[model samples]
Target: MITDLANAMSRCRRTLWQDALGAAALMVTLFAGLHLPALF
Candidate 1:
């Protein structure tokens, strides 16, 4: 039973990490899109 709980927690952590990385990538893309044109 304890092992099951640990496995579930690990999956949740992995999902959260993926979500964080996705959000970071989106923010970076948006920042570049908004600023890149101004440089030229």
Candidate 2:
């Protein structure tokens, strides 16, 4: 039972980490897309 809980916690942490990375990438993409025009 303890092992199952640990496994579930690890999965949740992995998912949260992936979501954070995805969100960061999306923000960077949007920021670059908007800022590129300003550089000209």
Candidate 3:
């Protein structure tokens, strides 16, 4: 049914959004880790 397809699409979109946020956080963590030692 169309409703099932819509639900699947929404779930996929949410998963992708979460993955993007996780990737951004990981990048920020890595950037901070690499630079924090220099600041001390």
Best model per TM-score: 3
1-40 in candidate 3: lDDT tens per residue?
A: 9999999888798588888999999999999999999999
Residues 1-40, candidate 2, lDDT per residue (tens digit)? 9999999888798588888999999999999999999999
C-alpha lDDT values of all predictions: 0.93, 0.92, 0.93
Clashes of each: 0, 0, 0
Instruction: Give residue 18's error in model 2 in angstroms.
Output: 0.4
Worst 10-residue lDDT window for candidate 1 reads: 9-18
| Pairs clashing within candidate 1 | none
Ranking by lDDT: 1, 3, 2
* lDDT tens digits by residue: candidate 1, 1-40: 9999998888798588888999999999999999999999
TM-score of each: 0.65, 0.61, 0.67
RMSD of each: 5.4, 5.3, 5.5
